[model samples]
Target: MTETMREVEAGATRELRRYAPLAANDNREDYSLRFAAVSFRRWRPFVVATAALGGIAYLADFAIGASIVLSFGFTSGVLAILAAALVIFLTGIPIAAACARSGVDMDLLTRGAGFGYLGSTLTSLVYGSFTVIFFSLEGAIMAQALEMALHLPLWLGYLVSTLIVLPFAMYGMGAIAKMQTWTQPLWIAGLILPFVVIAVREPGRFAEFASFAGTDGTHGSFSAVGFGFGMGVALSLIGQIGEQADYLRFMPPKTAENKRAWWTAVIAAGPGWVVLGAAKQIGGAFLAFCALGVVGAAHAVEPIAPYVEAVRPALGPMAIALSALFVVISQIKINTTNAYSGSLSFANFFSRVLHRHPGRVWYVLVNCGIALALMEFGAFGFLNKILGFYSNVGIAWIGALVAHLVIVKPLGLAPPYIEFKRAYLPSINPVGFGSMVIASVVSIVAFFGAFGQTAAAFSPLLALVIAMVLVPLFAYLTKGRYYLKRPNTVAGPDVPAALLAGTHECLACGEHYELPDIADCPAHSGAICSLCCTLETTCGTACQEPGAEPVSLGMPTMKLS
Candidate 1:
């Protein structure tokens, strides 16, 4: 070989060495919260359903909804919540499908969509923010329940609430699935008993509730400004779909026989998360109405206290005690999810940013730490406006994600399925990433009254709209090059037996995957599990088998019409 050719080869070898770890996994930690080789995916459909029910973890859904009602009255609160639910349902479908079909996390999907290898760091902040911020909120609710029923000190309650989660989380999904399944009946009973007793005792109160004016003193009339304001807050839950997707990834392999169950689980857990969420929101509004009159308007929106009161009419003092239990259990159901997904986001953040693969558990604790810090700083008092405003940015990110997954990919403007192996994808795809940034900027501007009070009030929704339109526009103009770098040839292929031997270990996380699920990772110079593929960072998009796909290199394309 010529001297220059030898130098080029040497450089190529060095680059390969840097990324060689991408193909391997650290079996030492076993994919963090993941269930490495477990076959629990084979369980009955009911388990999946119950697990999906766990999506009802956040207390803010109810609190936020109640505040909307208390601020805007029934018409605005109810209507705004319903509207937000509809939007969330539509957006969550494609995102959930990508998770189940590809069996990768949201971070991986974002990487392939348009954010280059390093570009996804922006999303990492958004997702991690969602996790930690919500964790503090949920943990605070847990503390409130403790203070109300058990009379525990607020600070201690916070400590208990936060620490209780560590044991369950460290065990990962095997522990979570079992815990969720076993607790479903108790959780259901706790959630319903208050309503059941309320109906028995306060049949006349609900009629009174319909006409109850909010703290804002807005009487029974349509207020466009209030409606817009309420929606700005309600729309923040759109990214809760990420939490749903986290669990949905474990859906067992779909086949013709279990097709019905699989689709039900996917839909129920995916978009259907909002249905239950909407119910909680409405119930929260109602409960706030019930309490606000008695507790003063400021305390009216607190669902836990009113819920305890309603249960007391029939269940007696036992209800207060039960309220305490309800708070802790519900928080556990949701916070595990919050912490779990948070950890995943941080893993994505640090892995992509620093080119290091810490165990997912480490990031989990890190996420929780940030949340606890926020709690100590008194974030709970400002939860309503805080969630409302943050929703704008959250919606922008997820909105772009959903747009690419549903709108762009289906029209042949982007890739058909998620390409997340890092080897086959570009370091950045501009379609999803650029659109999200633009959407966030515009929505944030609108939020700040730049476009008038009405527009500023409902900026989150605006962001969502902007991302939906811009992602497709960018995809069309860029010819979908932003999605991947090398053409995708790994998935939907005949597998080599040696690769799937069920014993082939990945070099990064150092674990073995079923041969069928394992793929050769040129980035790491070894086989890699799908999860590790997402967690890898050093590999540039060089595993496309040489022109097998148009990933991120800005190559010219040939039309296939």
Candidate 2:
């Protein structure tokens, strides 16, 4: 234990070098490497705020909500959505707080939360799946916008929307924060206008909407199988928090002086996003109902189409222009987030699996490339099934992370502050990784036909519960050693003798960070940024500790003190 403590203390402390660009694109040696700098660390509050809002893109949410209504009717769909929001709220708080507190992105946060070093690679895949899948879905929706608004071909419009944002997302926060802020107000008004107009024009639609039969034409009541199925579909939003976390990582450090704003920002941007999401879901339902006469039920369930038809009754030309603008703006806002997070996920993926990174820009291309391919194939067709299936893995990942943040930290089981620096962690921890798998397996089985029909209908809810419970179970069984191979206390607070407390220049990106984010690259034998550390694929995590212990399982008996 003492020996391990000595190593941890030796590496834990670090001092900042001169401010340099963090998360820089390093495409030279790694071919797909990206590194973040500490120089532009502090961002204006509104930038963060708008960027967070960008995830609200794709009005497809309305479609998703309407899908619930079409499939299950109102009562069950609303109930399932409410229940899912509650679960995401409970589950999201810890994960969001951890990311804010640790100053790490989702991938880095996962590593410290319990995923371990390599353990988080799987999470990168899962998290990346959310971003890219949503990217294509939202982009496809954008293509629809162009076709509806400008009579463009679907394939050409898809190509246009996908390539359009490459420039903005390519630059990371520098570009996106501005774009999000500039467009938020317009998008918000455009989204709400249809609802306002519809309220005045069709007073009876809301009341009549409640009794509408399922899209499947089944007369399933509140507890009917169709209702459960609809709710399950709406409940697929279990992982939207991943997008929220991508933006929340940029949250300015909270302080006592700004306590109110800090708390408010965290809540509004974090778990609180569901308020907006729920409203959109309900709005989607209302829009679908109102559009019954114009677009009919077949296309009513489509979010943007309903709004276009709903507003057409109030304003003809304006409705078309507004809907087109809303769709485009929303898709851009949301897709930017998707592209950003996907790039980060791709970075984590290559760094862990291939041990080589080219640059942030390269991964951006990689993720976009995959999304484009999915579009060419029939990704939109499997939207619900894919989301449902992916929700299992997402639930497990969130469950493990939440367990660490809400459970282990609060109970004195894990360290209070997050220890995310690579030098002090083992390659993996089983508590999070193992438990996530268990939760995913159980929930997925239940999602399939393994359980009764009703359970299968709401399998995501089951998955969420099971993942939440299983993560901590595995953590306790592991005795918590797997959480960290080395303790931060080793180097001591205020200052330390060893570790990279002294300044070091990054050999790859030519930036500077603390020893915590900097590691000696064996290939270069020089200090490299954490992003470069990850992008360096040739080393194969050689600097990382052995065994790659499953975070959901347990670490070896070896103690870190």
Candidate 3:
């Protein structure tokens, strides 16, 4: 035993230069690539949910809502919005639960859900793109508000908008949660004020809005083609659940005592976000209808223009200032989340590719920098075009994730719990990765009109169907062998209470981690933390070799000083 202990001590720490940033934990880097430690999961269910839900404050919903309604007319647009909302809500349920219960972010969850280690790097790219794209979109909205209210040049406003969110996001969840909580009341009030004013001041506008023919001259009649196209646009927001999971992973372990609150928070802040999102879309359509005569269809889709018009009756001369303020507040609340989650996604991607993790904070610059560039090039000008196309890829990725979590896992075709540790997972799992790729390729081809106009209009829906079908098909065909490279019987059961019950000292980092984040390692000759497992390069996966002692499956036997 003494000789074995000495050998373990001499095995080398092998800490990555990049992991220093995460080790600092000053900003609660909060285990960006590993399980969110139970020790740090201190927030109440409601608080975490609030922080997650707060990320949806971006006015892009308004833009998306108005654009679809204006292009497709009232009936088709409204039906499409409701339909997309239902899809997002239902899919969000299992995903949100899995992430929260596993204490891992979307990227980690993806790895365990059948994408394997390197396979999920693609998803990291997909999710990171979602953040950057939306960051640019939300930043553009705020920039417009700045330009409108203060005459700031669009370029300068973009710069200002980009700079403003850095301080809040740099500090990660602690700072972000407080900011989101503090601003929630004001945002809610501002959100509803314009609609209330419209209702009271112009009671007949609602009736008029219902029958408005739209810019396409559909005469307000429902068109199947228009509805399909509109639904595709709305489905782009499916990626928003990933941002929610980033926060939801920090949820405290659900207990019998907090069960009701836990479920409520998970549902409301998790999948239930689309409920409010759908309402906001409808409200945006209403506001766009109210402003159509004043601003014309071109400017009506810009959220600031319709918002200013909607509140003009109530606020009079102050409408512009208040509307600008609301826009700024709303954008800040969401853009911080975008930058924050983007950093997480990028950090996960590069860490695996480069085998180094400089930390989550540095990637905030990468995320925001990319977004700022996008704004400069006018990504917002192609709002519908960009979102419409992105919806296909986004839905395909999300659809595969949801199908694995909700269907295959329940049906015993995949692991019952998440297995995210790199030491124990294969480099790639074809189940999810292959499904997402095939679905994305096929749907994108359809989106580009290769499959006819109607197919092009509904490409994203096609992606969803293909991905959902493929997850179970691939899982069964692979016989669930690829889900985990090795079984994990170490520490304890994967339940929240069991995972949070004890701590193990990671031999590589000399830090204690909860059971869920620590794994046995033959290469290190001791138990190692997941982050250390991810960054270690010299091991060459000796732990996973045939008859290699199966270190990750059983508890570590080495004594810890």
After superposition, candidate 1 runs with Cα above 4 Å error: 1-40, 492-511, 514-561
Most accurate candidate by TM-score = 3
| Model 2 Cα lDDT, one tens digit per residue, 262-327 | 667777788888888888887887788777677876677656688788778778877777788888
Which of the two, 1 or 2, has more lDDT?
1
Each prediction's Cα RMSD?
Answer: 7.0, 7.8, 3.7
Q: Provide the TM-score for each candidate, comma-separated.
A: 0.86, 0.85, 0.94
User: In model 1, what lDDT does residue 140 have?
Assistant: 84
Residue-wise lDDT of candidate 3 within 210-317, one digit each (tens)?
887788675478888899999999999999999999999999988999999999999999999999999999899889888888999888988999999988878999
lDDT of 1 by residue, 230-277 (tens): 877878887788877777776766779988887888888888989988
Task: Please give the TM-score that candidate 1 achieves against the real structure.
Answer: 0.86
Model 2: how far is 12 from its true place, Å?
Answer: 27
What overall lDDT goes with each candidate model? 0.71, 0.68, 0.88
Query: Alpha-carbon error at 436 in model 2, in Å?
Result: 0.7
